[model samples]
Target: MDEERNGTGTHLSDAQLFALAAPAAGEPEALPAHLSLCRDCARALREWKAAVGAVGEADAGELARRSPEEWRAREDETLEAIRKAGSHRHSIPAWRWALAAAASLVVAVLVLTARRTAPPVAAVAAHATPAVAASSDMSAADAADDRLLRDASYLAGGGDVDSGSGLESRL
Candidate 1:
């Protein structure tokens, strides 16, 4: 039925037919051009209109006959059911808490174990000092080379070499 209505598939949608059949304000809706061209859509629209009419015709005398006290009791019962549903609590099971605690304990033990097995920070820093000293010594050598180049340039330009301290003495 759905395939016949929409999948094969050039007919009007069920919603469009329903809207034409049951206009909300009880006014007749304008028919689409497709409805005049398509027999299936016309039949579907008639079916929808009949269904809507049947629903509208259903007797409401039972509800109309209900006393005010009966309606109040029904309302009270509905409210009590809603209150009971809202008040019910959902609790975490005990095994879930136990599992969570176990996982936390495992993580804590792993962290403590790793800390105990690793080298201390003071010892690591002590081992790193010799490498740092070596780098500083290399920089000092580079500074000495730069000073020699500057002095050689000054001498080549006929500047007084005797004005500054002797190169050997500075070295």
Candidate 2:
């Protein structure tokens, strides 16, 4: 079937021939004309139809031979195999749990270190305001933006906003 066609007219591929075998409603306009004119295509269509019919007969024969109990037992075995495979697949490894714990510990340590290093936000704001107000070049908006940035950093480090002595302790 794969060999180069030695004849004159173009022939239908295997897929087109199969589609013509079990056509949807009124078959394609050109198919009937092609099948009538092309002997090779007609033969291929017949072969595909025969193969389909043979498969249907085999399925029917198999259903008639197999008892309901035998079918149920096969289904049960397949389900048990799936369940066993799923159980092992769903469980996390010990090393993965250990890795997660280690990551959590590292995060906790970093949080504690930042909290210890940062001075209280009140002292910082007090010293910052005087310096910002004295700067002749600094606009009120720029001073406000600077204060917001410093406050954000202080909050991120978990420092107490109302505690600590003054700028001297921070320095």
Candidate 3:
């Protein structure tokens, strides 16, 4: 930034120049053109841009100075820091992993044991008779339907059913 005085020396701070540039850079109006027209503001903008680049370079150089082992250590530290920053961000605990692995192993063993020790399904099937019946319309009302009552004598006599009350009563 240039703080000019008529035949007198003056100066401007980097902060002031940066402040002036920040607003114009964000604006969508003629302020940007006005910013360029002021050589001091333009120079100040370049200087700020360069300063940022320099800081980034310094950071990169510092990171590059670490040995591979040190780099790994730094990476691990960063990961751990990030993990610690949020309690939920870290990995599962070793004990939890072990428990899960043990559970899986036990499950596998039980499955294998069950496959071998359990009785064969086909053996059970061969001995079991089907329990479901198809039809169930037999009732006294159906049997005593007046139109069919003419056959009541024969029905009461009974061929398939032994009970003297006859088929419907036996059922």
TM-scores for all candidates: the values are: 0.31, 0.31, 0.26
Candidate 3 lDDT (Cα, whole model)? 0.60
Reference-based TM-score, model 2: 0.31
**Model 2 agreement with the true structure over 49-74: per-residue lDDT tens digits:** 89777777788987757889999999
Instruction: State, as a TM-score between 0 and 1, how close model 3 is to the true structure.
Output: 0.26
Worst 10 residues of 1 by lDDT: 1-10
Give stretches of model 2 more than 4 Å off.
25-30, 64-171
Best by lDDT: 1
- How far residue 79's Cα lies from its native spot in candidate 1, in Å, is 39
Q: Which candidate order results from sorting by lDDT in descending order? A: 1, 2, 3
> Could you tell me how far off, in angstroms, the CA of residue 159 lies in candidate 2 after the best superposition?
99
lDDT of 2: 0.73
Local accuracy of candidate 3 as per-residue lDDT tens digits, 1-171: 346622323334566555554445666223345344556665666787677667777889767467899988989999898878766534457668899999999999999999999778987665442311211444657545532443465665654334353445534
Quickly count the clashes in candidate 2. Answer: 0
- Regions of model 1 farther than 4 Å from truth: 3-9, 59-171
Question: How many residue pairs clash in model 1?
Answer: 0
